[model samples]
Target: MPPKSNDIEAGQAIKRLPSNAELVPHAGKITMDEPAYFGKGIIKDLKTTVGTHWRQEMTNFNQKTVAVSMLMFITVIAPTLAFGASYSTATESHIGAIETILATAWIGCAYSFIGGMPLCIIGSTGPVLAFTTVLYDMSKNMDIPFYTFYAWVSVWMLIYAFLCSFFDLTRFVRLATRFTDDIFAFLIVSIFVIKAIGDPFGGVDGILFPFDPNHKTHQNQDADYDFLQVALLGVILGFGTTWLIFYLRSFKNSSFFCSDTMRSSIHDFSVTFSVLIWTIVSKVIFKDVEVASLNVPDQFEPTYQCCDDACTMFFPKECPDQAERAGVRSWFADMADTNGKGWVPIAAAGPAVLAFFLLYLDNGITWHLIMHKSNNVHHGEAYNYDLLLSGCFNFVNGLLGLPWLVATTVPCIVHLNSLAEKDKDGNILHVQETRLTMLFSHMCVGFSILALDLLKLLPLPVLNGVFLFMGVSALPGIQFWNRFLLFFQQPSKYPETPYTKYMDKGRIHLFTIIELFFFAMVFVVQNIKAVAVVFPMMTFFCIPARTHLLPRIFEGWELVLLDGDIFEIQEWIDRKTDSVAEYEASLRGDLSEYEDDATQ
Candidate 1:
């Protein structure tokens, strides 16, 4: 009930009491002034998932396990093969396919079974790999042993991650709106696309990074193929792999040659199926042609230190036992050398701080992308928990002389889409979230060396094809690219999004221009050796630019339509349509009056 005016007046003399609509505080405090887990919010996580019924999540899990596992295997293998090789070159660390595959299995399975967000797949990623290269160069220049300096850096990184989790700093990730995420997504997707087909679709293999001398030697010398032929063949096989995967994945919507069960299996195994076909073509037709092969170890062996990138772990570049070496190996790196220098451990804090931010931002942003409501992530987010786990994982890897792991973006999405049961309009009905897919897929990777020679039979171009397909596949989800398309499109035939309805053309284009600026800057920084170590941090500038700068030009309504969350965008749409209808009606009324007056 409302307080009477006289009653309010009377109360004003003594105290003003809140009315019915207002929430009144009691005399005594009922809860803590600050939440105990404000920074380490695990209970909030439970509310996101455990609050929802568990039985239904389990039901979806049972229905899709076998199919999802197959999909996971394909997605895991492609990136593991591509990224592992790249990481080796960047860091000068021989974390070859076997090491990369094993790390993926260990981290993926652990995260799947224990992680708060089941959708995320943990592995090595491009940004971290690039950043590690900077450290490797620094260690060599400073006369510090690479592994010892790296261990100290990893320890510092772990400390930073722990502090972030404790302080609840992961919540800041919410500030990275569509403006930043779209740029990062498109940047990565662009890498995959350009790598498959050369920038012009006719140039040599060097899309952005040039070819290394140690790169696979050509096997097509007998065929007398020139530069153009090899480049063209790479383009052909790459696109072929990409298209084949897409064709099989799209079978779910086909009118024929498709049943629900068949569609499920096809979607799950499409990537692996496409890769196998292309591998045979490279081996039989090309006859072991100069295409890149995964540099697997000759036998089961752990890595050891060496000056050369290609040196096997057990032997250094000039080992005394180089010729008469036994097959024994050591997995853990020796940190005792640094234990005496002591300054190396302390100095590590400087680089560690930079590495910390790189890991934190990259890992957190990827989490937000996978868990975005649009993705229909039913499980709760464990941002704090996962950050801590990732730190621990990397710290252990440091001890083991293994490469650090982080959340990989493309593989995670592939895993989710493979298991997601969608409706006719293509929105997720529910994800078949389970550990089995990740666990089983990783197990396959751990034992991959069992088929060592056969595994090396797969050509690198096929992986490039997977890369191209992933980039093309991701384009549909990015609004920045969609808005950019409107520039070349007819206004009358423009696709309907919240912005197309409420925001003006000039405003939307300006929004896209800002995103492009950030994307371009990050790309430049990533390719430039001097500043590339801070590439992920450079992307953070987009957030403040969106919050403070862009609003100066666009109104609240326009901004919401252009880059707001789902509910805000929908609200703007409804309000704008009503305003448009009112204006049209008033204009009609005036036109009719003018017509009558002229007739009179």
Candidate 2:
């Protein structure tokens, strides 16, 4: 491919080469540019085709595999912290930590890879945790071991998720829209706000129904005063520590100031390290301050020790001498050790059937929208096969004691589109050429959960703060409505429009009215707990409008090119049909009338 030595010296290498005139050979041959040669490339692609296909298959398989590790970490860590803190106000259980971490990691693995919109990192959620705590309380009273109840709940959740997946339940999610997502996001954010923010300001007093208000502690002091003081101190510490950490992290990377990486690293370290220092300092200061610290046991062990630190407490090994072994016997019955005394197996037919239908509708809706937004994975809006696989994944998650898992999020599509090169016209120049950053981000999350210790050190309040920040950030995406309103208002910018040109001069009227109403309703519903109880659950209604109605309606409008206002409906009729045909028929009737008049 290199230029001939003569051409190199001549400095005219770019000129087209001329063919040599040969007397003895059939020399009517064409020459091609050296740069145009693609023979080797074609062969190379062919050689790697099978390998490429196999790797893609493997990556998908690993989604579920990696999820297990993530699930284990949460299952062990979250519950241990929650339970140990709750049970003995002063004591912490290391056993609960290990169990929670493992269970959560297992569930996360299934959720991350297999479910509809497989982007939501599912593990131990707050509601589920609350549910578990209730079960634990009930089990203790009934002489049933807590883990047995947890196992039962897990079984139920798995069954629920599986059934949901079976019926392609995610389809219901398609009904939601951006507005709906926003509302749901708002609701979730409100719950966090109420717990973390509102609880400090007399909000907890409203819910104190069955409490022993005047109960004296074992120390002959009012428990309420101690509880209140400790709660207040905790609230202050949690919020202050969370804020400091966030600010530190925010300042770590300075793009504008050109700060050095060393400085950034120090900032990052200080945030977490300072929080750790404060936690220790707070404990030392409060040694006699009556506030709780971490309740971990003296030693950590890996054995499946059920009673003390385990995910759920188990049966007492021994009973008192004369007290008829009711507790022990009941524990056995709770574990279903005897002839079906402990376990009441429900027919999978009743609840399982209900769960399956719910999951199918839910999964179908979420997946379809995810695919559309992601752009890279267009299974099409009407795809049945993709729905089938999604259902199958959820069904499997249920069997593994996971909460009903569904499609992961579709943010990867946005990441893929970001990397895709664009032409002058902004169309994608090529496909599958860039790394899917968000999907890879999901992988990173899975890996972190697997690593265990990395995430464990981060304070829960900081995480909650981050969640709050993200929820706030999502608010701006809704501002596009303002832009749409601006466009609608400027009809002169768009010359041809029946509604805009004639009906209204300013879209400000409609846009402001609609947006204000939506905002008021959303804010009121989210803030007032009592109103939420009274209203129809709005989240489900929000989903489909986001996914299905808007897209389909837009498609319909584009297909028909409908151009008419309320006043111009009759004008849209065909002129030929109305004028020529109808005119002829009218003429015949007029002639008959005229002939009768002439005869008269």
Candidate 3:
């Protein structure tokens, strides 16, 4: 007969590899030693990363890759046009839709080919948008050409990026814990959620519900009813798209589905299918109703018209009046168009410092999240090299007066999740890591300039629904979000993870509360324009807070249970059990010796 399960477990030994601290004995402690400088291991790092890069892409040629490419293309386009419009408003048309789309296409294509992580989709972000707006305002106040000043700032930031990379400063990202990462990820998710739902209190300027009183169709006798009709259709399209996507994605697990392969295919192309379904609904069923669509540029030209007679070359029949085109600029920024002040270039470094920190934290944190263990990404990291490349791209963009782009969190997460092969329990088995999706998607964005009218058929609310799905879908993976939901649940019914099993409910709540406090601080600071420039600094403070402050409140073992990964928690438990076993053996030996002495 076989041994009983419990009896066998009692005789089994726990196995674990030596941790970094155990191997080095001084791994996490501060010490004075010869540091790795001048990109000491960057060459070898690149060699390892690049060796498998092309081979990985070649092996990923399948239907899933094509499906993901379509999904990402749609995902990237909405935000590009939306942010481009916002940038034009903020900078008074110095940069606009065409420039943004072009930047997204060119930089995205280049990075997909050579970036350290091809899965990370690079694009413009909210913080970079805010920083550029502030820089433009400063240039205006100081009586300098905004583009020229922006160029100098970009140059200084480029210098700073190379210097930091050469000195291996990106190694500091290892100090960031899940505490910091979750907060930032939650903040981004919140933005997407809010934008997708639109204003509930009857706002006309919402992304999906752009109800203008002066629109051409609104001048009819039944304007009020027409507004209501449009609003109702917008709601249907937006929420309907979201519902269809969720239902189709969940169909894979349903018993009534056609076949396993058929259901999986439906799940794989859920987003694309949802978009198509709703778009057809909008176009065919409500053909006469007016709804908001994408605002694509009619031609691939600079958004800001020329200020001088050069306008006649491009638009001889309908050139703008001289007075209307006074401060307009061309595609290339004039470096010498400054206020004739020699100190301007040096002064530009001030804003460049803020830009550097913003890019460093934003890029580093997003990369950290991508390379996170939960994502199951096998590609090695190249933080320093990626940072250097971003700086170079920004320098070129500044020269051409285009918006600076970074590793946008939402799109990166969406891209990663789309390519991930998950089990029935929703665990990531493997990510279809490849370059083809981003390359093909971005190439389509570049080609979109020719088919602007075709793109106009995609209603804004359908895209908003996609945004809502992306944001809501990301929430399940976040531990913080899971814990926050526990605030309303009974303690007895809580899910039995290592933390919930070993740690007290009160202690878990306390740790979550502290994280919430920091998250609130970052969120508040990010929203306020006056303090937004220090947003990166605010996030950076989380590293020190997690490292220095939390250790005082909780015991080391408890922290491992609460904040550590699965392997970490297991190792801690194994170490404690080993120590207890050794103590028992020592006590037994002492007992035997004492018995011998007594007998003698």
Candidate 4:
């Protein structure tokens, strides 16, 4: 979904003197204090937006939808594909690119039609991959079937998601500041970077245990990969893909792109185009190397197996690597086989509760980032409602034995920027906001399930490169990263962002120091096996630190300048600038301080 087009222009537009015709922002058509859902003004928000976006799409269905759909088709599929491959490989589960595409396309389509925040792009993420992977390992050791245990976990996740909405825990999400958002954002992006650098298979883990293709022997779970022979190709393809992505993103501003339509098209299809070009290049240049390819099959098939002869045990060590996924049919598998006398599902609830907390934090903070005032998304926040809807979707995913989905950070950011139309000044004027683009983009993914073989043609290294590009693109926006740059940047030449405008340079340094500490803590916790399952809980720790500890350390104005919404910062800037002008007037002896004011 497109963000509000005026975001980039907001700072400048608000500076001009107020007039009747100058654009004025409306504080959403409906407002409700979310106190345990007591306000209950949900219908009011829904009614106001019923046809606003739909009408825009109807008016230019052929032109805009085609461009966005094409662009989204290219962008959406690769991540889901890559995520599917990674998740399945790590967990030894039946999840594949096709299933991932199915879920993403299906759930995203439903969300677009009715979900409140269209800007939030949904997909499986690094945390959930880690979450599910750990669960699978646990169930296997305990002799519980993975999917059966997964089904129970899914039930608990949905229940908790609904519980979160019902009790108004949704309100806590609003309290997230840049302090917490950057920490999680950094964590998500780094998964890509670390994965690519550490292993040819992807992720921070440096090894992959390949199995015998002939299916003749027991594959060692600890088998180590020697990527050094093909590592050079990985580096070349990865960096090349990354460069193409960065180049294409900035290409919209290039003179060569010329017309708006051309630039828009390039911007929309940049990721897909970059991936395709490099993939072809890798095939031609590295044909001699036995590099990894995507695990996508040519047609729909079961990623897992189910049979009367199947061993009912969770992950039998006697079973070969492929045989673990060889038990179930591609379409459906019942949980009754592994629920372990109805008590396992009950016990699974404890871990399910933990997973739901992470899901809640990740989803909430992502929504916070996308809907940040600076992003200029004008729609009302439906925290409670969206949470409930996600629970329904996840419950369905559990039943189908598919990967659970969450709001992916980079994709959502990319989606918003693509749908925007910038002015000569390069600030967004307005977005061509419509659900059709999202709907159509996802529809293409659903249709592409049968074409998985085509995706396999591209070497897996190229996909790794795409991941690197995604990680790098997300780095600049992080507050801690920007703040860290100050150590090398000369003080007088600091960038004129809100933090610089209203925060003392030294205080900003201290603020980032505190944030950096949080980032390091979460990173350590997520990577450490003992604490990884509770990573989201560790991430949630930032909220209380900001809410309680930070206030005691920094003054109210400093916190506002550093962490407040755009309007709040602008208000502080206005007052401080006025005070500075008055001080300058006193130095010039133009007027007494006792007077109302004098020109600077």
> Top model by lDDT, which number?
3
lDDT of 2 by residue, 1-600 (tens): 644424432232222222111111222111222221223322332234322342342354332232222222322343334433333221122124433333334444443333233323333333223333444455455555443443444455455544443443333444343345434434444444454333432232111111233422114545444555554455555556546655654554445435566554544354344456546545566544443333333333332223433234322332223323222111121334222334423422343343444444334433433343323442123223334443444444333322333332222222233233344433345433211222343344444435555444443433333333323323323222333445555556743433333234344344334434554565565445434322223335444443444344333221111211221222322322334443343433333443465599
lDDT-based ranking, best first?
A: 3, 4, 1, 2
* TM-score of predicted structure 2: 0.46
Over 4 Å off in model 3, which ranges? 1-35, 199-225, 310-329, 576-600
* Cα shift from native, residue 482, model 1 (Å): 0.8
**Tens-place lDDT digits, model 3, residues 1-600:** 533323323344222333323432222222232445888645645766666576777467888888899999999998999888888878877789888999999998998778878888989888899899999899989988888999999999999999988888887876676778888888889878878886442231344444555543345545345776787788899989899999999987888666898888898899999999999999999988777787777778787765554332222114544345533357787777676888988999998998988889889998887777767888787788888899999999999999999999989988999999887656688998898899999999999988989989999889999999999988887888989988999999998777787678998999999999999999889777787767878888988888889887876666666666556667766665554554443433333443365599
After superposition, candidate 2 runs with Cα above 4 Å error: 1-99, 110-118, 126-169, 198-236, 245-348, 353-538, 543-600
Top TM-score prediction, candidate number: 3
Q: Give all TM-scores, in the order shown.
A: 0.81, 0.46, 0.86, 0.80
Candidate 1 residue runs with Cα over 4 Å from true position: 1-39, 46-59, 62-64, 90-95, 198-216, 219-233, 283-292, 305-316, 326-329, 421-429, 575-600
The residue-by-residue lDDT of candidate 4 on 1-600, one tens digit each, is 422323233232112222211122331111234475533433443454543454554355656567667656655776787777777677664566667877898998998788767767888776788888888888878888777888889999998887777767777777777778888888877766777555432323211212223211122322453345455566677677778877887767787756977876776667778877877777776666556666565566545544325635234443555444435453554667764566887888998987898789878888877777766667556677777778889889888878889888877766666677666544456666667777888887887775666767867666666667667766776667888899889988988776786567888999889988998898888777666767778888898898879877877677766776677667666666655565444444443443643343
Question: Residue-pair clashes per candidate, as listed?
Answer: 2, 71, 0, 9
lDDT for every model? 0.67, 0.36, 0.80, 0.69
| Alpha carbon deviation, residue 484, candidate 2 (Å) | 16
Q: How far out, in Å, is residue 511 in model 4?
A: 0.8
Query: What's model 3's TM-score?
Result: 0.86
Error of 3 at 51 (Å): 3.2
Please report, as a residue range, the 10-residue window in candidate 4 with the lowest summed lDDT. Answer: 21-30
